[model samples]
Target: MARCEFCGVEADFPFICSYCRRPYCVGHRLPEAHECPNIIFARPPDHVRKIFEGRLEEPARHVRPVLTSELKQLLLAWLVLGFCFSVNSLTAPQLFITTLLISLGTLGLGFIGHELAHRYVAR
Candidate 1:
């Protein structure tokens, strides 16, 4: 049988404080009731806490899109193309403007092909 950490009572169905991971009886189940130490550390510093203390509560929102979002994936695709082009140009400096254009076109097509493959696999 588990015992409550605060009142030392035998608990049949103890509630655990998530932060400190301690068991408590129904009466002391809440963090406040057990005077949980985590509550103090979880709070922001006094100076920063005061600034937003009176702000109106707003519904939670996503701050930013995921790194793998479409926009980021597209940007990464272009970046890889540019890097490959730069490395090829440096290695073979004799390539003419026509060759550069062909390389760019090929990379663009390759990027499109990759996207199509990804979509096909997803379906």
Candidate 2:
């Protein structure tokens, strides 16, 4: 049974917001005119707290379209860095330091690329 997100009362007929798709029981649900365009309506915070249970919980699914592409591009970029790190590891006396620096730089680039993909592809 759908319940009000805010007050936790059983809902007669929950309204699923077009943006976020969270079920909101009527009384707890804010009226549409008051909602912000940038903010998708969500189940009450307590509901999400119950659903997630912990701060470390992973999202149920990777619903974003860019996640796959971001991961693929990040993998390829890191693969190239791995090759370079391997070469440096063989030749350098300070292998650990160089590897750490290169790894951090690669991660930074990968994050930037991921953000770019999301920005370009997001609706």
Q: State the weakest 10-residue window (summed lDDT) of model 2.
A: 42-51
The reply for model 2, stretches above 4 Å from the true place, is 1-69, 92-97, 106-111, 114-123
After superposition, candidate 1 runs with Cα above 4 Å error: 41-123
Candidate 1 lDDT: 0.75
Best by the lDDT measure = 1
Global lDDT of each candidate = 0.75, 0.61
- lDDT string for model 2 (1-123, tens) is 887554566767887656655667654355463252435443344433233455555446746775687578766766666656556576665885677567757765775677678878985
lDDT of 1 at 37: 87
Error of 1 at 103 (Å): 54
Q: Candidate 2: RMSD over Cα atoms?
A: 15.7
- Tell me which residue pairs clash in candidate 1: none
Candidate 1 — number of clashing residue pairs? 0
Give the range of the ten consecutive residues with the poorest summed lDDT in model 1: 42-51
